[model samples]
Target chain A: MSDPVISVAGIGKEYVLGVSMSGNMLREQIASGVRKIFQRVERPNRQQQRFWALKDVSFRVDQGEVVGVIGHNGAGKSTLLKVLSEITEPSTGEIRVRGRIASLLEVGTGFHPELSGRENIYLNGAILGMTRSEISRKFDEIVAFSGVERFLETPVKRFSSGMYVRLAFSVAAHLEPEILVIDEVLAVGDLEFQKRCLGKMGDVARSGRTVLFVSHNMTAIHDLCERSLLLNHGELVADGATGDVINGYLSGLNTDASIKRKVSNDADAWVTDVRLIYEGSESRQGFKMGQSLCVEISYETKKKVEHLGFGISIEDCIQSTRVFASVSSIHGIQLENVEGEGRARVCFPDLKLVPGRYMVTITLNAKSFQYDRLEGVRILDVLGQDELGTGWVLSRQRNGVVWLNHEWLLDGRQ
Target chain B: MSSAETTEMPERIIRPKTGLIGVNFRELWRFRELFFFLSWRDVLIRYKQTALGVLWVILQPLTSVVVFTVIFGKMANLDSHGTPYPLITLAALIPWQMFSNAVGASSLSLISSANLVTKIYFPRLIIPLSSTLGTLVDSLVGILLLFVFIFGYLFGREFGLIEVPVGVGLHWQLVLMPIFFAYALLAAIACGLWFSALNVQYRDVKYVIPFMLRIAMLVSPVGYLSSEIPENYRLLYSINPLVGVIDGFRWSVLGSEFQPYWPGFCLGATVVLFFLVTGVMFFRNTERKFADII
Candidate 1:
């Protein structure tokens, strides 16, 4: 194998905390300078603290490797990309990069709102390190891909945000830089454009170009990257094949389930506890298809709220797809009066969900006002069941997400 | 677009380095297209909707000359070295307008493009440099108008429509106009680099620029000639740098009796060089923090 295109060793980035305050910075600096001169010795303020955005982050990407960086907010994913892009210097260690690099920190960077779409194509192309002739070479393709040909001469300020993102991404994707560093810019634009972006990214990866992609969207990461890295609190916790890393991240989330909030707004109602309980057991695990499953919610209301009802929404954790939603009010089963502390339980006699991890969101509300809402408050892991009597697990690979009760009759007359 | 052998491409090490040796020339050269586009964007946006698009460029210096001619020439009767006051003042206003507008916009360049700085990975110097170039176009227009006035005054005096008592003629020193203009731009860039870097960290620098320019206008030889200063303090006064530009500018275009004072011009040039070297050093030192802080 050839030498790695990008190599980073012991890279650390440190930021001084709480230095930015909303005021005239010159006056503050002048006052500080004067104080230092008078004192003859400057000391760091007590309120100041040191934050390490990245610590000992070591990685190497061989030529033409597509790697996905997955992490939650404040997990140093952005700092890592910034360090690689050389937008900011690392406080410690070294990074060696080969070939031309184009980094897309956002869509439509360096685009002037007053300039027309045709003009912005050239401007944004140049900002991404594309030469003038190179932009003209791909000009027609970019316009066609963006689907903004009708408004090509109109100023970008007049274009819808979706059109703006489409044009920007089209120009960026046409760039032929050897190495591409992209942040979560795909989060913008419509679903169709997002699909096109993914397709284009896949083509770039297939063309033997190195790519460093950072995103919170797990499905995209799984689709485009064969290798993945997991970051937690500025540390590289895992690096392996995409499946293992995603599994490591998802199961890691299971331990932090049952999120509770102390919302003081109105204080009408708030959830205190939320969990999925297996039938006849306090264990929170071992949920199975076609098994009795119960979702228990403990909440409190400072004042009596009429028509109080509990709602639950189930979402597919991996794809973030909403699977089902049901509310007591919609079922015409609202409580006449609810006050103080109480426990509410919703039981499914035969849970029809296929085997997968699902996220549950609970909401407490009345007729007109929403008291509180908590999303992803709990995780339900459903195990596959053999409800079809096929001697094998009833899995989504065969039966889809839910099981249906149906009878099958076969007549053998031959 | 050439599919050349990859062996020809140079590898870069992105280690943190200190001091003046840290500039990446190859990277800057590769992004030259961006530099041009950014400058072009600024120039195009400035006059997009104005009814008299490029005319505003000439209009600014012309109106300023009229105002200075009325107040400084008619009311105050400030000395103009025996040349037409309008000719001499307009000659200096070309470079002065260029310097003021360039420095004004360049200093605020980084602050205004905070989005680009924090989000992208191009050289931060491009912002100020492109803005300076954008304003250079305006200065060129001002220069064109200065010549029109000089010839107009010559013809108008012959026709008895002008009352100025001095001859308006070009001199051999006009060959040095490019040198003088270069100095003006150098001075602007020097201050621009310093103030643009400072503006990122201290936003009050933006407010300080206009106030500082007003004071600068009074102290520099914008409306009046450097000869009016007492002989003893001429060297001290010429240290302002714009004094040398104005002095050399009038001498070059108006064919005035005032010659280029070598000592003051040299002193001013040295001061401008000092600002250039120090401004670049300081800007490079603080640029890495711009993305984080901004």
Candidate 2:
């Protein structure tokens, strides 16, 4: 496929945690020499530790391909981009690519606060490898796209956060590099600006340039990329079609039991385990978007309890907005007068959720006081089916966290 | 089956090297318009918030001349070799102020813009070079004030209160003023390259630089005339590069009997060139670590 425009082989990066001292002065050199001489008897303490931020990562992207790198925090996504961009050298292995690269690893990265917005646009463009004539030709288009034409002569330090991101993204997207590497910078601006940025990225991809996008939002990744890579704890866990890799990543998250439980030393109660079942049998770890699902919460209590309520909540991780919550009282299920050890099961006939990752939380409470809560007990993946039609899709777009059934109005003639 | 497909094909993609040593000077030259904009921004911002505005430029060297006249001319009763102390001191102070200001500003240029250095790729040398150029505006203003003072002195004497001496005609060699000023600028640029490179790795260098400049000012023959030194020790005294620059300025402006001090000028020129080359190499070597460390 056209010699793979970008090739990364066995790339790894190591960083030292503490300060490094060398022979910066004559006295320091003599002191270090004396310490080395005395090392025959007693070794001096070295307070440095090494961490591998990225390890043995290898990937290839064909010419004019848009690839998405998806992962949770600390998954080595940024380190991979930094190495590919050559901002820093990899500790081992090698990478080879052809043509010019522009990396938008950060918004407003090289902007001088005292410089005006118009001035910084040219400066940022040059830093991205654009010539003066190229930036000059595109200057008006950038300013107009950013919607900061009225404040063009004002110093960027005075611009609001939204204005800053708009200007920053405008300069970056218009620079016209052969390969573009962007990392979550689009998440900053308002909704309309974000949509514009996505549209611009789509245009750039369609124009035949290679793009490497890193983000936590699965829907954005699925919408933009045909091929995707999933990173898990500095390892390449999966790489393939966007849907398959995303589904595989969601399933892999369900099997991690330790990650579900919140461990606290001073807690009165804590969740120990969580499981999902259906029809009296352990079903596939997750459910379809509108399928019946059962959840079981197992916890330990340090003291006897008289009155307590068990509850479960579903929340969208990206937006951190709670979607649906139910308490034991609402379901007519309560465990009281005996609470030394307990397990509670809650079942929903049809849990309506679009195809995305949702965090399930378990909480135990006595009236207004909450004894304990497992912040994120389990991650659930709900798939979509055709029976719901485009109505369900509209609801999914309106509120990404949950899917609720509702009726639509008709005209008087109908 | 015979219908032609209307699908569009994807464009070609290319990737280039991102190493600091691989900085494309051609690209920097291509972006020269941005450099001029940044340099102009620095010039404007420098004076924008100041109270006295551009008047501070003329006052800086003039006030220093007054202080030097009081301390050396009146208190120490130093000889000006038949020339007025104010005229001689003001000529020397003009170039000295420009040199000091350029070195001080350029040395901290990298650290001052830590936010910009880590995020983007530009020729890091441009920061210091632009800051050095920013000081030229102040030096130009100082030069204008010096011309006014010379005109007044010549006019007042022509009105007959003071006798005008013949054969003390202004020498055409005064055109070398620009050359001497260029030499001083080169010296400042050389020191800037050294300090800015060092400041990136060790922040203590920033604090130590002002102290070093203070000591240099005392020893650089700015307040005292080079003629005060014994003829035998004059050769050793001129080893301080500013001594030759100050002697040249005073000789050009005030028509002093002093010679051009070509030996001192040659030594200063050699030292400046040496620092300039080595400073550039050192700056290039340390530039790779700036993004990581900064």
Interface RMSD of each: 2.3, 7.3
- The lDDT of model 2 is 0.76
- Model 1 root-mean-square deviation: 6.7
Give lDDT tens digits, candidate 1, residues B135-244.
Answer: 99998888878778777777877899977456476678789899889989999999999999988888888889999999999999888877788999989998999888
Predicted candidate 1 versus true structure: per-residue lDDT over A300-353, tens digit per residue = 888777768889998777766688999988878877677788888888888888
Where does model 1 exceed 4 Å of error? A20-24, A30-46, A256-316, A319-414, B1-4, B19-22, B157-167
Candidate 2 lDDT over A261-345, as tens digits, reads 5545445666677777766667455677667788887777767776678889887654445778989978666667654566778
lDDT of 2 at A367: 64
Q: Count the backbone clashes (under 3 Å) in each candidate.
A: 0, 6
Top-scoring candidate (lDDT)? 1
| Complex DockQ per candidate | 0.45, 0.16
